[model samples]
Structure formats: C-alpha cells, structure tokens
Target: MADLEAKPPLSPSSTLEKQFEDFRHHLEESESLRERIRAVAREIESVTRLIYSCLLLVHQSRPIPEVLEKVKAQISKLKELFHRLAGILRECPGQYYRYHGDWRSETQTVVSLLGFMHWLETGNLLMHTQVEERLGLKTSEFGLDIEDYLIGICFMSNELPRYVVNQVTAGDYDCPRKVLKFLTDLHAAFRMLNLRNDLLRKKFDGMKYDLRRVEEVYYDVKIRGLTANGDSTRDLGIQGQS
Candidate 1:
C-alpha cells in the first residue's frame, strides 16, 4: 500500500488527448471542405457546359435569350460559391491564401472566366478590361482577338494539365487525386463545348445552304413552267410532289 501510494495515479496525458481532439477536428473539417470543393467543382463544370451551349445557340441564330439569362445567373452563383470558399479558406492558416498555389490560381481563373462571359453576353468591353486589371490577364495571353472570349477557355485548358499533374504528385494534401480528376473533367468539358459549338455552326451553315438551294430550285421550276398570271399549271404531278 505504501509503494502504491508513493506512485501517482496513472492518467491519460491531457496534452495528447487535446492533440488527438485537434487532429480529429482537423480531419472532419478537411473532409467537409473537400466535399464542398467537389460540389462547387461540379457546379462549375455544369455551368461551363451551359455557357458553351449558350454560345453555340447564339452563334446558330437560335433564340438564346434564356440561355444567356441562365449563364448570367450561373455566373452569379459561381461568384457566390467563390465567396463561400474564400470565407472557409480564411479560417485556415494564412499560408494557403497567401501562397500562389493551385487553389488560388484556379479561383482567379474562374473569376476571369466569369468576367469574360459577362463581357461576351453584354458586349461590355469594360468587363474584359476589368478582368485584365483584376487578374492581370492579357489579350495575347489567350491568343485571340479582343472580340473573342473563347480564348480564355483555351488558356485555362492549356494550364490545367500541368497543375493537375503537380497536385497528383505532391501528396501533401487530402483529395489531391480528386482535385486532379475535377480539373481534368473541367478541361474535357471545355473542349467538348468548343467542339460542339463549331459543329453547330457548321450545321447551321449547311442548313442555310440547303434552304437557299431549295428556294432556288423552286424559283427555277416556276420560271420554267409559269403562266401569265404567275401560276404554274404544266406539271401537276411534279408540283404536287414538291
């Protein structure tokens, strides 16, 4: 009893317990953040596709007022999402937000894209100028004329691969692999959207040509078989077939 009493009671280390609790909290917060990131990433991808669809629709002379409206709405949502993400990030230690890491760069890229999209829709060149001022993007950086915003998509696609590969190899963070996948999916979405836009433009051009040819054929047949009263009566079978 004396020996036992001489020794102090054994208890878990409060420091270790607190450390473990902090670690668990960090893990939970990280997981929640990753989920939010994925949700926003998916939203960004879908909005990108919708924007591309609007571009193609407007290019094809389709009534795209609704699409344009939706693009604007989605862009607004993206801005809100960014704000939320930034808010969460601010809770983190200052290193991440201060460093020129992939997350920071990617967020800025989204801002530039949104700005340019507004410029395209509203014909407000000021939007593009402001984007350049805010993001330090240049017209030559995208390899396109001043009137074109699709060039920004190209710039984004070109830069994504390297950043994704780096994230995959760095292995310092959780969900690096998921981040890579999201970036890749974004690049793919942009490419597909661009291709679809080109195809739709071609299809519209072809349809216009076909309509013109049909009108030409109708006029030629009418001129060849017209009466004085501007009516055709010679070809009952052919006219009926047409």
Candidate 2:
C-alpha cells in the first residue's frame, strides 16, 4: 500500500530525455566510426603511395626481377594495410559498400600497380581472383570491387604505351609489338563489360588512345624495317623516340 504512491506514470519530459540520450549516443558512435574509417583510409593511402613508387621503378627500365624485388616489401605492407581495413570493416558488419568509397581510389591504384607487376612477370593480365588472393581478401565481405578492378585495368593500360615508348627509345624495338598486343587484348576485354559508371567509361575511352599510340609505334617499327629480322635491325639499336 505504501508503494502504491504513483510514480507519476513516467513523466513525458523524462521519456523525452531518455530518447534524447539514446540519439546522442548513436550520434557519437557514428562519428567515432567515421573517424576510425578516415584514419584507416589515410594509412592505406600512404602504403599505396609506397607501392606506386615501387611500380615507378619499372618505368626506370630496371630489370623486372629487380623491380619485383624492390616492390616485394611494399606489396607486403599493402597487404597488411588491407587486412587492417578489413578489420575495421568487420566492426560494422554488412556495410562494406557503405564505407567502400573511403578507400576506393587507393584500392584502384593498388590494383593497377599489382596488375602491372603481374604483367611484367608473366606476360599476362592479372586476374581479379589473383588480386584478391594477393591481398588476402578471402571473403566476399571485403573482396575487390569489379568496377574498381576494371578501372584499374584501364589505368594499367595507360602505363603500357609509355612503357613501350620508353623501351623502344632504349633500343628495344620488340617491345612495341608485345605492348600493342597486350593493349589490344585488354581494350577488347574491357569492351565486353557493360559499364554504367561514368568514370569507368571515361577511363576506358582513354584506353583507346593508348592502344592507338602503341599501334602507331608498332607500325613505325614494322614499316621502317626496324624489327630484329628487318634490314635496319642494327640501326634499331639507336635510341630515339617512337
């Protein structure tokens, strides 16, 4: 009977205060997650830059074996960073796409660099599955985005024309034929996808120019009889622009 004193039916004001507190807690948690994602993204960007620098050594005309050796450390670092990214994402399960933009550009760069390296070593395009395996992304939750992979392949294509030009200038006339074939195949493969993404479409468009440039170089070498089997094979060793 003493306890029957009404507890004021839980005042409306008190109910509102409880609701406000819940909202504040959720807001704080959301901010915390955003901050954490940003921090991880920055770290990923840094490691990606290092990986890019290693890939740049390829442009220096260093032997592929040596370039691969130098990049091995950076590639390992990148894998670790990706693992860290995956860990952070696990904290918010089922929201991989939600935070994907945070690291989208860097992931594309990584894919481009890795794809280029793989091509150098094996004379083939790096498959998406191989990229996932290299990055230790064994789960669907954090697997490489297909669009990013395709875009990265486009970026890799951009590198080849320059590489071919450089190799030709360095007296490697055979380089253009090899690079032209690669770019031609890559461009055709990219055309197979029905890309709705504007950025991807733009990048693919640029690939056409790259293919044309490489083709021009290949024709120059071919028509001038500068190939290894041609009359100017000896003169082909002279360094000059394509």
Alpha carbon lDDT of residue 162, candidate 1? 37
Clashing pairs in 2: none
Alpha-carbon RMSD, each predicted model: 19.8, 5.7
Please report the candidate that would top lDDT against the real structure: 2
Evaluated against the true structure, the overall lDDT of model 1 is 0.44
Give all candidates' CA lDDT scores. 0.44, 0.82
The sequence of per-residue lDDT tens digits that candidate 2 reaches over residues 209-241 is 888888788879889788767434224232232
Task: Show pairs that collide, candidate 1.
Answer: none
**What overall lDDT, based on C-alpha atoms, would model 2 receive against the true structure?**
0.82
Candidate 2's C-alpha runs over 4 A off are: 1-20, 228-242
Best by TM-score: 2
* TM-score of every model versus the real structure: 0.37, 0.85
The TM-score that candidate 2 achieves is 0.85
